[model samples]
Target: MEYGNPDFVKYAEAYGAFGHRVESAEGLAPLLEHGIKTPGVHVIDCPVDYSENDRILNQAFLRAFGSRRQAMQKVLFKPATGHGPDA
Candidate 1:
């Protein structure tokens, strides 16, 4: 579950393509513009901090579908081994 982040820029260059890494927020727009304007398979490695994913995504989901969460759980927990209509 914990696959470490690889150097995507180097990986792209290994394949003989253009690669760029966004070092700061301000650099993103310019790098994106350059990549789009002139490109032959460009890869931009923009590191993102997802530390608040659980708080942001889970809480929003719970708020939106709180009443239907239990109902949805039944379908989600159902076995998937069946192979036919009668199985």
Candidate 2:
């Protein structure tokens, strides 16, 4: 595992780029607001934890669908009773 800034902020500095480091969700709003308020190109360094990716994605999907989990499941996966495309 290489140890360094994954967002490569140093490179941005070398190129005179505008950026903000977002260490947590709390920093996101300010960064977003800054991007919206400012006119120049901006970079937001927001690293995410991929370990809980499944749970995070599932929760997001559930929230978006709003209690249509079963319907989403049917659309995402076919029946295993050998009555679909595989059959």
Candidate 3:
């Protein structure tokens, strides 16, 4: 699951890091189990689809802030005007 970027497995291997390259969600459990059961450091290279991630994040954002007028009354979050109470 190496973020679909340049392979970094060599670095891990050089340091004796043990892990798995998970291309999908299904590979998570087994890799996690192996890491927990075995000793020493482990790593999981999980790549993600940027486009799909963007879409999902956008949808979640809309759902959370859909009712702007109502939400604004209770909380000081305003994405539209970008003005809110000091943190």
Candidate 4:
């Protein structure tokens, strides 16, 4: 381990789970809902390439659907509404 990262750093890194960062502004909708203020709960927005995402998603589909690429096509690609949860 480096000088900065000691033996305890590993444990800290494991415990410190990163927040579910979203790469899109439109995806901030559901986050504005209830229970958002709970401890350790966070939401962020950024940008990512859909094509690369598609490739990675395809692999995920393969795992989910036995290597079937069609599994990825049946996905809903849409942003979210920033309305409150009760809305």
Candidate 5:
């Protein structure tokens, strides 16, 4: 029920104000309301599960969006070097 990043709330809201898409897990639904479809973000109702360690990383999360937006719906995770941060 509590977000790890307190700043995310204010930051997300600010982005919403600027017409930037906003989405979150089901729990965050309480935070983003009143403007479900008014040029705003889409709050996904999926929980983050690191259980997919063999698949996702922090950067994977960032890349997925751009990939989806730029015609590459498939978010390839290259944890080797060609992708994500130097983790």
Candidate 6:
């Protein structure tokens, strides 16, 4: 299911915190630096495109391991007892 994209900057500001909106990739570094150096709760609303997440992560996993299935097998933990929620 999809959710509404709320104005995170305004939300942060409403809670009496520092809010910064990154307009471009160049602005991200400066905003990050400012947020870290400054005091109080700081929120940086950096828009990210997650469309290529699966492809990128899968490629990285393939490079690290031999294949995506191998990576999943290594990372995913399976309970031997089978006494958990799913059981």
* Top candidate (lDDT): 6
Q: Candidate 6 on 1-87: residue-level lDDT in tens?
A: 978678999999999998789989999898888888888999888888888998998889999989878888877854366677877
lDDT against the true structure, per candidate, is 0.84, 0.74, 0.72, 0.53, 0.48, 0.87
> How close is each model in CA RMSD to the real structure?
4.4, 7.1, 6.6, 17.0, 14.0, 5.5
**Candidate 6 Cα misplacement greater than 4 A, ranges:** 1-3, 54-87
Query: For candidate 1, what is the lDDT?
Result: 0.84
Question: Model 5, range 5-70, lDDT digits (tens) per residue?
Answer: 344445656666422233555545554564464455643333355677845654475565554444
lDDT of 1 at 21: 97
Residue pairs clashing in model 3 are: 1-21, 1-22, 1-45, 1-46, 1-47, 3-47
Q: Give residue 65's error in model 6 in angstroms.
A: 15
Q: Count the backbone clashes (under 3 Å) in each candidate.
A: 0, 0, 6, 1, 7, 0
Q: Residue 12 in candidate 4 has what lDDT?
A: 37
Query: Candidate 4, residues 2-65: lDDT per residue as tens digits?
Result: 4632334234346773344444676666554532655663434244456788788767888886
Candidate 3 lDDT over 1-87, as tens digits, reads 556466655567778887467888988898889889999888778877687886786576568878646556546653455457652
In terms of TM-score, which candidate is stronger, 2 or 5?
A: 2
User: Ten residues in a row with the worst lDDT in model 2?
Assistant: 4-13
TM-score of candidate 4 to 2 decimals: 0.24
Task: Give TM per candidate.
Answer: 0.60, 0.49, 0.55, 0.24, 0.21, 0.52
Better by TM-score, candidate 5 or 4: 4
Which ranges in model 2 have alpha carbons more than 4 Å from their true place? 1-5, 54-87
